[model samples]
Target chain A: MSRQQRHDARVPIALAVLGWLAVAFFVLPIMALVLRVPWSSLSDVITDDATTEALTLSVFTSVITTVLAIVLGVPLAWLLARSNIPGRQFIRALCTLSMVLPPVVAGVALLASLGRRGVVGEILDDWFGVRLPFTMPAVVIAQLFVAMPFLVLTVESGFARSAGTVEEAARTLGASPWYVFTRVTLPATQPAIVAGAVLTWARALGEFGATITFAGNFPGTTRTLPIATYLALESDIDDALLISMVMVVISVVILVALRGRWVGAIGGMR
Target chain B: MGWRNWGYEVSLSIDVKRRIGATQLNVQFTVAIGETVAIVGPNGAGKTSLLRVVAGLISADEGRISWDGMVWDDASSGEFSPPEQRPLAYVFQDYALIEHLTVGDNVAFGLRARGVRRRRARERAQEVLDVVGGSDLVERMPSSLSGGEAQTVAIARALATEPTVMLFDEPFAALDASARAHARRLFSSMRSLSMARLIVTHDAVEALTLADRIVVVESGSVVQIGTPSEVLATPRSHFVAEILGLNPLSGQLRGDELSLGAMSLTVGAHGVDDGEVIAIVRPRSVSLHRERPEGSPRNVWRTTVEAVDRSDGRVRVQLGAPLPIAVEVTPAGFDALATELDGDVWASVKASEIVVQPA
Candidate 1:
């Protein structure tokens, strides 16, 4: 055989074995959950009042969270990527801290800041007679807290990676700054934005620690799919397995649907 | 559109100084309506930067840019208009077409940005694309376009804006040879428009053929600015001469006889009064010989070949001392003479081949 052909065919046994082991480590749990699903009672478990409430709540809250993230996170991403704001690095780190922070810690931080006697929460309570804890808004806030950083970081990298020459050309062609941002910059970074939104939605759908800690698990109000799965683990393991399988299916479908954009975003970041 | 009177007024005037990286760019020039000026220089000579300053993409550190009696930028006053505030269009080197939009939408973008109706903007885009010979490219995506097609679409996009001033930064640099020729003809037709135009290019042929006046820049400074023929016949700096590929020798002119240091050559008829002059010689006109021969040529000199460079089917023999000049010869001609590097060779040029101009 040619030397190059032999070299191309050769695989390091240690690296190949370790890589396969890593793949098996991730795949085996999902395979076990799929196997453990009670096939005859799957429909019955899914249609149960607790499962329906949790699924409906999770879908609605995650959708709102994704939309809110796009609305608020996109502009912040643009500022971080393109503006000369003072202490921009510090601001970016603060915004994305939740991405790496332990979820339970994020829940504690949110509670401290937004609880009844908390800093902003006391003012909100006195001024408007409103309480945020143990509410639907609180669930959304909890999801947004942990989920938005994925979107902000992804779209920020997109904004930074896209060349400014096209925007400059648009300006010279008489496009106003707002028009350029809307028609040119946003559209040019759409792939990353879409990938980021999907990631944010998925993260919100799967939220557990933050929602249970800050929002306090409440049926049909704050308890989302992940919380339902955890609660079912205490009473009925079969129901927990079914809910887990549903989440896995939904996540797999979404990721597969947007595989191209997700892969492109990762490549662009690199 | 029939503003045909040349040199009527200076429609655009710029006197700007700025520091760009390690290069301090100081340039001043004026362009009248219906005038097309080509800026020519080597890489990093600030040609593109000069265009950017005028386009309002980059503000100069000092001085003023005024067009049609209106100030666009004044550093002392701290008054600078952003690019969108200027009635200008810039065709970038890479076309910079919006990849997400169809070619029609890309061309229509400027009009839409200016608050034109969508239907009207699309119609205008179609008309402009037809004018630039890109009607068939309207539905195609920018990503699907070839380099030439994208360049044409970019031109159409710029033209659709109907701008008062146009800036082109190496517009043809990305095109193939045939496409470059086509684009040159297209740009030549555009010169008749009544708006001021500035084109940045390193192509000598483009500068000479397309510009009413050529501005030669070197190390971020304006070295020379004149008509193409004037600049070509009397290059003021070695950079300009090298760019135009001509050998310029300073000499004293007495009647038709020009003295080149210790040597003298009879030059062609120049009607100017006798004084210090510069003579331009084309390298292709200088012939190399193995031995001095009896000839009708008026100028002959013995020089040693300093270097032999062969590229693109032609050989350039760099002759050393007495007159340090380069002679371009065909490979067949060079092979016939049997000249080697560092070998002594006699060079001769006809008297009429020399162009004499005022120093």
Candidate 2:
């Protein structure tokens, strides 16, 4: 064989080894959790009330938060991606700030702006008879704030990639602006939207610091799975390990089912 | 002001301004109802911009466009209709088929967007597909279509909208030779569908054969407007001549003879001075002979063949040294002359066939 052909064959082999090494590094913690869990005490931990309540609240609030993100963030995404509005760069940077901010920092920012003695919270208590801190709504709001940037960033990138020619063709063919958006623009960005939703839902499910800081741990209302697992780890290690396994198992199942779709959407964008 | 007698016509003179760059398309022309006018120019010649202005896709910063006695855009009065309100259909260069939708759904998109019933939209899509000779391609996805099939579906989609004005921007630019011929034939055979048809192309053959009138644009302005025969017969500018494949020679004229790059040719009655002048001669007009034929033609020179390249069914032979002239001849003509490689030849042209214009 020629020298160039031998070099090409060796390069791919080296890359494959590096890729497998990275996968093994990521899987180490999950493998440890599986190895350390006690099989005999699994049934007892499953019957515990705190475990079930945290799982239920986590599912309920994460789904609600994702819906809120879709309702509020899609328009912003469209604007950032497609329009020539003034100060667009600054607005885009501001929107992406939440994605990189620590969850605890996000929780603190939310508290300063929406706590009882804070900006809008004081007026809400006085005029609307409402208290927001340490409540279920607070949990939902914190999750929404931290997770919405994921959806907006994904969808905005999608819009940027779609060629403007198709939209112009739609307009010249007697489609109104709204009609064009609903028909051509929306369908083109659908895969991005779905992928963003999946990522945001997963992030919200695993959220911890923001939920605890903004909405304190309560038995049935505010304590989601991550908070419950932390509290159980402090008092009962067996129960905490079992609850951790449940989180790992559920997330693994979801990721496995969605692997093909995720890869397809990401590859299509490229 | 008369409505019944006059048909749909577009008269536009456009000037647009933007921050990055600007286009001042000060073009004034008319397209009679049911007549096909082709806009031909190089890239960045503002052909698509002019079409966009007519289609109401973008408002001109200055000037006006009137259609059938109705004002579509008037800068002085700030009157402009949105694109959706215009009676136009535009076929983009990419075809722009919706990827997620099936071919039938993509074609039916405009009808559905206009509030037609779903079943009626499907029936209309089928009917339009039949017109474009693509009836069997309805159920397939757009991702599965070949370039030609997708373009046919795009044209069918445009036709389904029942528009008065049809605009196509470089629709054949992406197609291969065979596909381009098919598109050209399909476009030429379409009749009585739209009130006005405007196609923007850079291909000379497309402009010559498809248009009743050809408008040549260069540097965002119209340089010439005439029938294809007239333009090809007497090109107004160098760009136009180059696009139409006419050989342009620049030199000086004294009395009846013209002096060019190391060669001399005779002219007609008119005489030009030592000032710069452009001499245009069609490739088909120059005849190559192995021997200098005894003739009354004013221009005959002894030359040698340097190189030859075949294009389509014709061979373009380049003459050597003193006059580097390129002449086109059919394969049969070349064979009949017993043309040899790098051999001595005689080039003859009539004085009346050469056009000399001031540079």
Candidate 3:
């Protein structure tokens, strides 16, 4: 073989063994779960009332959360990426903080700020006679809090990497700033936006710790797939495995649909 | 407020000073309608920065930019018009075609932005694309276009706006020789239009051929502004001379004798009384010999061969030391002395061939 091919192929035996072991560590659990799945009754288990309710709730809350994230997060991402605003770095860090924060900590932080007896929550409660905790909206809020960072960080990075010259070229062609943003900047960054939205939706779909902590586990209101899966594990392992398999299938579909864009978004984060 | 030239009036006038990092860009020039001025400079010479200021992409720190008596930017009064409001089009170095849009849509962008109906804009875009020789590319995506095709589309986009001024930054840089020639012909045809054009290019040949007037900038300042012939025959500075591929030697001058450091040459009759002067010598006028040849040439120097570059059927011999200059020779002439080219040689130039200018 060629010299480069020979050099590349000559990996140390110890490293090769460790690499395969690491691969096995990730693959083993998924294999075990797949093996335990009762294929004959899988459809019946998935269509059961509690399972369907949790699945429906997960889909509904995550979709709404994804929409809200795009509405709120895109402008914030643009501001962070393109503006000359003071304290931009600090604001960006603040916006992306939840991405790295533990899910339970994010939930607690959300509760501390929006809980009935807490900071803005007390004012919201007294002024509007509204209680946010243990509600369906609370589930969405928790999911948004934990998941919006993925969208914001992804779109912001896309904006950072896109060429500013195209926008300038548009401006020189008599396009207003708003027109340039809508026609040029937005379209250029569409891949990042789509990738980020999918990532946010997936994160919201799989949310467990934050929903349980802040939103509480109610079958029709706050309980999502992960919450239902956790509760099912206490009584029925097969039902829990079915729910896990559903989530895995959805995740795989999203990854397959995203392909290179998802990998690019993840790489951009690093 | 405007200078009259023939029948048309000067439209764009700029006298600006801007400090970009360490370079202090102080430039002042005017582009009359139907006139094409080329900004020629080395890298980091603020040619692009000057274009940016004129296009209103960047504001000048001092002085005023006015077009047809309307103030575009006046740093003293803090009045500035952004790029969108300027009656101009900028062809960027990379063409900057929108990747998401079809070629037609890219060209139609300026018209659509100006509130033209979509149908009308598309019609106009097609018309302009036809004008720029890219009508066939109208339906194709910008990503699918070749370099020349992209350049044509960019020019079409700019033309769709019917702008009064055109700013181009190395517009032909991405094209191959044949494409560049095509683009040049396109530009020449467009010269019949009344719009003023300011093009920034590092290529001397491009500047000489394309520009009605050449503005040579060095270290963020205009060193010379003249017609191509005026600039070519008598370049003011060593930088300009070097850019024009001529050798410039600065010396003390009195009558016919010019003292170049310890060496001196008998320069032909230059009417201007001079103290310090620069003498420009064309590379082709310089002849290299094995020994000092018996000739009427007034100047002869022993020069070491520093480098030999061959291109376009000619050889350029770079001489080093006491006198550093370049001498051009034919391929056959070069072949005769090919073996001895690495060593020292005698270079001689006639007095009449040297152009003298006040330093």
Candidate 4:
């Protein structure tokens, strides 16, 4: 064996200890929730009308948010990937701004634009008599605002990678521009699109600070899983832990299914 | 290789000026209907750029490209039809078949783009796949196919649109020798089906064997256009000669004596007097010896062998010394010479083998 290989197996003791503690630091919360399941009344806590209402609202809002993200994000991804519009850099920066900003800040920004008596919101109230905040649709908007950049950025990179000579070849074969995009570009980037969708869905399901701040957490309307967990924490700690366990389980299952490569793809896309 | 365009009329005329990065392409060429032209050039010689412009992927700065009396691009009139409106098909080197699509669907992409119904498109795709003799691959995904299979699917896809003109850029460069040979045999059958074909390749043998007319491009310009035999027998430039495995030496020529490097080579009579000239020696005429010949000197030079490349069942030895020259030899002949890489050897050429061109 080489001299380097002989010494490579030994690691510093303090590093080993600290590394174990780091794993425990992130993993212990889920362990705590699992240990504190309160198995006796688990059914009561899980099937309560309020719990079901919040769970249904979470599913509905997150699903709509994901659909909305795909609808708006794919075209945005295409435009950013393929077109040479003026000020595209600025536009891309704006699209990705939510990814780096705190979720609460995105909530405030959305409120400022779409809330009653807030900039465009005030104009919207005056001109069209529309009040967006504290509505079911506002719940979707809050989740979408914080989650869209994941989809857009991931799919944009996919578009960039696929927008090459194939698209040109498709065009040369008498494919209309729209046909080329749908037939060649979209199919080529399908893996990235699916990966982006999974990320968007996961992010939307966990949206809390934004939904609470902008959508105003009503039990059946805007109290998504994260917001419901937060509310239960203040009133009933066991109930909160149960909701936390549920969130943890779902996130774990989804993320475990995706494993490393796809998450790395999304992270790299970001 | 033997197809003739004698009675056919010119269908595609490209006289365009384009600038790609620092290299500007100012080229003029035409291909008659039923004529397949092979564009051979070094890398970055704007061969692909010329094809792209002709295929309508890029517009010219100022010129006209018309096919079948319809102007595809006329910069003077500010008129340019985008690629989808043009009746042409381009197959890129990478094949560009969609992995998500079955071979059948990939081939049907163009028909769908033209608003054909699903059943009709699939049937048409099958028909074209049959034309390429790849109907068995119809249900297969592009991911499952080999490089050769993907290329056949790409061609089937291109032909599904029934385009009048087809442009291929290094279509066989990605394949192994056997696959390339198979693809070549399949592609030669296309000569009877295609109205016009322009292929960009750096392989001289491919250019010689596949094209009815060969256009030699260098520095983004058309340097020569002739039959394959004409270009192979009389390559115009050092680049073309080197690519075609011809020994090209540029030097000063006075009367019948040509000064090449430190050695003077005797040549047949040439009309050029006391000026720079390029002398070509066919590789077959170049003889190699393990040691100096008994004679004092002729066109013999002691050189070192650099590399040996075998193609088309013939071995070519690259010799580097006073000049780097490619010499063709049979495998048996090379074995008889017993040459090793970087070993010293003597090369001799006959005066009758040299052809002089005014430089």
Candidates in order, TM-scores: namely 0.84, 0.80, 0.83, 0.81
Q: Write the per-residue lDDT of candidate 1 for residues A1-270, one digit (tens) a residue.
A: 899999999889998999999999999999998888997899998899989999999999999999999999999999998999999999999999998899889888888899998799888999999899889999999999999998998898899888578999999989888999999999988989999999999999999888898999899999899999999999999999999999999999997888677666856553
Chain B, candidate 3: TM?
A: 0.71
- Name model 4 segments beyond 4 Å from true: A1-14, A267-270, B1-10, B243-359
Judge the docking of candidate 4 as incorrect, acceptable, medium or high. Answer: medium
> What is the DockQ of the complex in model 3?
0.68
Q: Best-fitting candidate, measured by DockQ?
A: 3
Please give, for residues A100-151, the per-residue lDDT of candidate 3 as tens digits: 8899998898889899887999999999988898899999999999899989
Pick by DockQ: 1 or 3, better one: 3
Pull out the clashing pairs in model 3.
none
Error of 4 at B280 (Å): 17
Model 4, range A1-270, lDDT digits (tens) per residue? Answer: 888987998789999999999999998977877898777778998899988899889988899999999999999988887799999889999998888889888888889899997888999889999899999999999888889988898888888777777788778878888888777788878888888888899999998888888999787887787888888889998898888888888898878877764655555453
Query: Could you give candidate 2's per-residue lDDT for residues B196-278 as a string of tens digits?
Result: 88889986655765788899987678889998778888888776776556666878877667889688898653333456777
lDDT of each: 0.88, 0.81, 0.87, 0.84
After superposition, the stretches of candidate 3 with alpha carbons farther than 4 Å from their true spots are B1-8, B243-336, B339-359
TM-score of 1: 0.84
Quality of candidate 2's docking, in CAPRI categories? medium
| Residue-by-residue lDDT tens digits, candidate 3, B161-274 | 999999999976788645765686678778899999999998666676678999999999999999977998889876677556766688988888888896888776554366
User: What TM-score does model 2 achieve against the real structure?
Assistant: 0.80
Where does candidate 1 stray beyond 4 Å?
A1-3, B1-10, B243-359
- Give the per-residue lDDT digits (tens) of candidate 2, residues A141-230: 989888888788788777887758888888887789999888888888888888878878888888888889999999789999999999
Give the winner by DockQ: 1 or 2.
Answer: 1
The digit string of per-residue lDDT tens for model 1 on B233-292 reads 898887676546667688999987999886888876444358887677878989988888
How many collisions per candidate? 0, 0, 0, 0
